[model samples]
Target: MLCALIGSACAGARDEGGTDEADGQGDEFGGSQECEPDPRGTEPEVALPSPHEQLYELELDTWGISNAGGDPVETRTRMNEALAWALDNGFEGVRIPAGTYRVGEKTSDIYTAGIELPGSMDLILDPGATLEMAPNDTWNYCVVAVRGLEDVRIAGGRIVGDRDEHSYGGADDEGHGVCVEGASKRVLIEDIELTKLTGDGVLIVGQSEAGSCEDITIRNSELHENRRQGVSIVGGIRVLIEGNEIHHIHGTAPQFGVDIESLSFTSKDIMIRDNSFHDNQAGDFVNTDGTNVWFQGNTLDQGDVTDQVDGPIVFWKRTDQTIRDNVVIMHSPTVNGLWGVIGYTNDDEPRANPVPNYIEDNVFEGGGIHLARNHGNAVIRANQIDGWMILGSRLSCLRLSDNAVNKAEGESYKFREVQGVASGNLLNGAPVALPMSDDAPFTNSPPHLW
Candidate 1:
């Protein structure tokens, strides 16, 4: 059932179930907002020490790239030549000057046949340069790939995909701007612009069981206007995505700012902090099945966009997530109604798992909590909500405490056939009894709009 939303998104990914910023754009868009420092009392363990300082700090033509004018054959030859040079005499770093290098050609392979990233080096492009993937009719193609490598960093410049010129004859929807695949570790991608992709702007997908990713960090980037997701995590661990602005992810299913869904392997210890997310088609964030994922201090806004399919956030019951200190502004709800966050991606039957989730210290303006059914053990505490609180129907061991919801005078907390402890909560300046009956606030008509 999870594959319905992500099956096509994971075209080259061997995981059958499929997968699963920039600075702030515009003035005062909060796209450049950073996270609260050391919430866990420590910095992330990112291994990005560039030790190859004395080796290869040269320019574009030094690596046999004389002319870069988006010619597929010539650019591919130059790229292969550069790659061969890097392979022969140890790659340290290379800089591409201000130019447009179009990669990929018709003679390349169908799946993932593009410019591959060399391990243990730095590929720094000039701020005015761009690496554009040449238009092809393939389902799977990566403009820049970091496959099964370590100690790599890609910074500066822009990497554009082939969404506009793709012929769509491959009959699949995976043409990423940059693909970080295989068992790669210690990779860092920062201060870059990734946009106009047929699939995700960037995809961190594991090809098989022996090729998952770890210790990955993507920060200070701008990813937008992708057909699928801004970023898709098919398989990864210890991934931190911070301080990016992601928006307007339309034209596909499950089009979140980030979709973390691992099928065969485990993807744990992920953090998405201090990002500005808005105008996404499906939602801002959705964890189909990720472990120990934290969404901290980000701004998720569903502004005047009325065609939102999913809400701002959707997480399955199997995830061990901690969502705290984020600001959710919801002007319009999705097909799942007005609750800004949901327990499932769709309005279907919920999955009942025993994982622990903490939803603490968040501010929801015109939005509310919707952790209905026996999803998990949720601790919903200390939030200022301006909308409904629909946590009902056999939710076990729930803790609803110290939350202030805007309700009518003499109104009570509406929970139907639920098992929970509700204390220190206020609805319309009154502390109505939540456990007074099976459906204490509303006995028959339990507040359900979807």
Candidate 2:
């Protein structure tokens, strides 16, 4: 009867209630009735892992390098030789002990780099180790230069540039602290202190025709008081810059903390997050013109100091970009004729068409956000602005929603021939009702009156 009901033949006889008599005896219809113990009743023993790579110490004193600072010409020569030896002998890591090392001119006409890190090397510096640069006019100036390398890691050091010692002769003659350029890949630079450079603190450039240097990471670093940008990326891909402190950058015209652009190609897939930017000389704390870039959780403050910064962020011809969860306080009196918390513009023809830009959940104080002649689809939502907001003359398809704008001196929202929707926004604690309709407007004409 049980086999007929279950549509299968039973291995043993069934009881009166249609239960298998051999149910607990490894029968086909049943299993053993005994309970099993849990395997995770006790914690498993674990072992401490070994270091990822072997460490090789380079004794500067053994190479006739002194801790007492002097002319670094000889030291630079020995340092490069040691680096070559390490690379040739297949060393994975090298450590420089704590000391002050001065680097100056290597030859009469050429200034040598303090250290040049090659491919597949981990260079570690002791906590008190310092590399000080002396003044020179050479264009090949850098404290650490990594060129045409792959899989390099530079961690824990102090690089002080010769800003006081060197004279700047335009942009070409300036020196950088750390430069990674020319076909470099998988470089990790972290936990370094860079200050008082004649040019920029760090520069990642791609000048090669083969391809732009890819997969670079810069984190937990401090760059301050540099002549130009704190960190400048000319051309690179998949770069991650996070948890950095950059400030007091005042040398060139656009003295930005991070400047991302390209001279030959397009820079893409870059992420800048959780950085602290304050007291920078220019208003554009972060200036980017790259595609698919993300800037989040960054804090930009122009302290009570007058004429410190002009704006928090500026983007040009960027696409698929996002700026969210950032607190930007632009309280300084406008300097260098630039003022705004956020600035967007597109002037280059064959323009990439800065579209689909999302600026949300950001807090802006003192100054407002501005859009200048942009012809893309943008969404400005859920922002708390303590100043005025301006839309340029040629903007199209903009959606502004749920934003609170406290009027500062002038108008709360200024529209200059913009075509967009203003819905659920608050201007001085009242709902804003602009004359927006479901109709396509003509070119160079106002969407509706404010």
Candidate 3:
């Protein structure tokens, strides 16, 4: 169940769960690495242990926390004591049983396993429990973090933000729900609910280096009404984001519902499927930077969008991405901005490629599709676009074939069922890019959008 509103956006929002651009020291060798070596190839695989070994067997109550002995009151003492004890012991995880535990401030780095290196840890939540963090009047931070940790798994339960009177009501910004940073590989976050955050819902964002956030799996969770990006990721490789319910994405800042950027970050090999995105007022439900991504088997419903941000799903320049096998329904009534899939990219080659993208096997109930950028390929084929609208240039160079447009509002839909329009779109908008077309095609489509 959702908790009280705490306060509105005015309350100081929670901080970013992931680390900022420059927060940790250059090195933290003060701590030794404790995790075992991963055998699933050095490429960082997000693999969970066997069910029996997965259990940490360490309860928050057993740490001599304030409320651990009984149905004790929520306090800072319990949180500190519990977390400290977990760190001191050899336990790799700290479980929160069914209860409403509250902490007044930010604790030390408990999520990550290695400070300078990368390792994994687990934090499991019992059903129907809440972990509330007292709203900070100062800087915003995350309820929990997996920063600099590899093979990290945070699953189950609900993470709540307590922003009653002390909560800043929209005054504070940069707060986030949960953040998984760059260089953190094989991270899995599933079966949880994150609400009432003043910032983005969950951010698997990138940093300065070209490292990747690979093998990430987020399923069966709900993210609502975040102040910033709902699920923001940058500079990732081989990521899987599926089976989550994301809605009501309104914020005081100019926030996108979800964004995947690869600007000087090199975000690549992402699969986003089997999710439900609805009632968002900002930009697209899914947006990508200049990288390679695949968006399939999802449902998008536009509800109460009162802003000027573009797209139910928008991709920036030079991004070799795919949009297929999904259902997108919009009810904007009047033509608000350039309604539909829009692309925008100029300049060719070297740093940026203006190639067309490959689009196929999708069902567009309403709205339209636009090649927002001038570069890259737009391969629209074998799709069912009913009541579709187009908002881009002529596709004389595009590979348009084998598509079905029910009521095309513009001429771009003229090649739904045709061939050779655009296929294998790539970054820098190159015509022959083929960025996200993995060597081995995915055998199974992702689960449906929540």
Candidate 4:
């Protein structure tokens, strides 16, 4: 079996000699089972394996760190000391073997972090390696903190937070599982499970005035049952968040799966794709307030529960944004208010127009798209919506086309004082007329389909 797997992997590699044949075995009938050759007369480019894929055989026990599951004092002390020593000794990576390592104590201050990673290091955790945080009341710390670093990778472990023991007082009493701050760059956080945290599972922010967190990627992680967001990006550039499962986030006002917002700075070039967000209580499942953002191929669902979610995707004063090819399934019949797949502008803030945005080719199972306030040069096309497509007052230069809405309540297309062209749309199996200019007050109604 091992040989067959290796052979299969090697067969996928491109032939350097420009051969048009696959290097694989035969079928049960002794027929060729190789893949078809690429007809494009060009050698396929081979991707280099990631450095984090290298196995670390050295164990934490070698550095006098005990994994004895109780009283994390000694283990935490040794782990911190070992990290310092590894950085000073020029070690490329440190391995935490498969065991539960208790990190912080219940009585410790909220500002205490379990491990602080140095620059240019890989902290590899084995499959069963767990960092269990001691139950505490404070909310000002994190299990792992990476700051002012470059080329840092934290992969393959479980971070258990003390949510059951922690109490939420206010914004001051918030903790996190992992916090990446300062001028960190080229960071990769992958294949980790973060559960039951008092705050966000991962918080990536930029604190320095001269620099921003750059080129950060978080993928293939599971963040669930957290009190706050699954991942919160305060300020970062060129961030890619893909293939994560974030769910059941509650106990806060904005318990989003991913929250990308600007704090004292602006973030750019953010892409969130192929992630799963379900049962989060936030107004927006994946909220954004940044520039050049792309959210594609994600599944946002509100499970059959009593929680009220404002929307699946919310944008606030964003530019050059594209939300395409996403599926949003809303099953919460008792939700307070029904929201569309995409919501624009915030209630309290002054209405700012988002320009050059595209909402295309998305499937809204029980919702539609809401463009609130003024919007400019935006295109909403080819979407399958099961609810209302609402356009607020003063929207200009908008193009709505080829959208299909089924079982829509009230008006299939609700336009209030907007100048837009809506054409080629089918509503309740009939060609929709141009949206009527309604003077009804703007209100997010419940799903009438249910």
Local distance difference test scores for all models: 0.70, 0.65, 0.52, 0.65
Ranking by TM-score: 1, 2, 4, 3
- The lDDT-based order of candidates, best leading, equals 1, 2, 4, 3
lDDT of 4 by residue, 146-188 (tens): 9887788888989988788765555532578888898688888
Once superposed on the true structure, which residue ranges of model 1 sit more than 4 Å away at CA?
1-3, 6-46, 49-51, 55-59, 62-68, 107-109, 209-211, 345-353, 408-412, 436-450
Clashing residue pairs, candidate 2? 283-310, 283-311
lDDT of 2: 0.65
Best by the lDDT measure:
1
- TM-score computed on alpha carbons, candidate 1: 0.84
Sequence-dependent TM-score of model 2: 0.81
Best prediction by TM-score: 1
Kindly give the number of clashing pairs for every candidate: 7, 2, 66, 1
Better of 2 and 4 by TM-score: 2
> What is residue 213's positional error in candidate 2, in angstroms?
1.4
* Candidate 1 lDDT trough over 10 residues, lowest sum: 14-23
**lDDT-best of 1 and 3:** 1
Q: What does candidate 1's lDDT look like per residue over 101-145, in tens digits?
A: 887765555664667766677778789888888878877778888
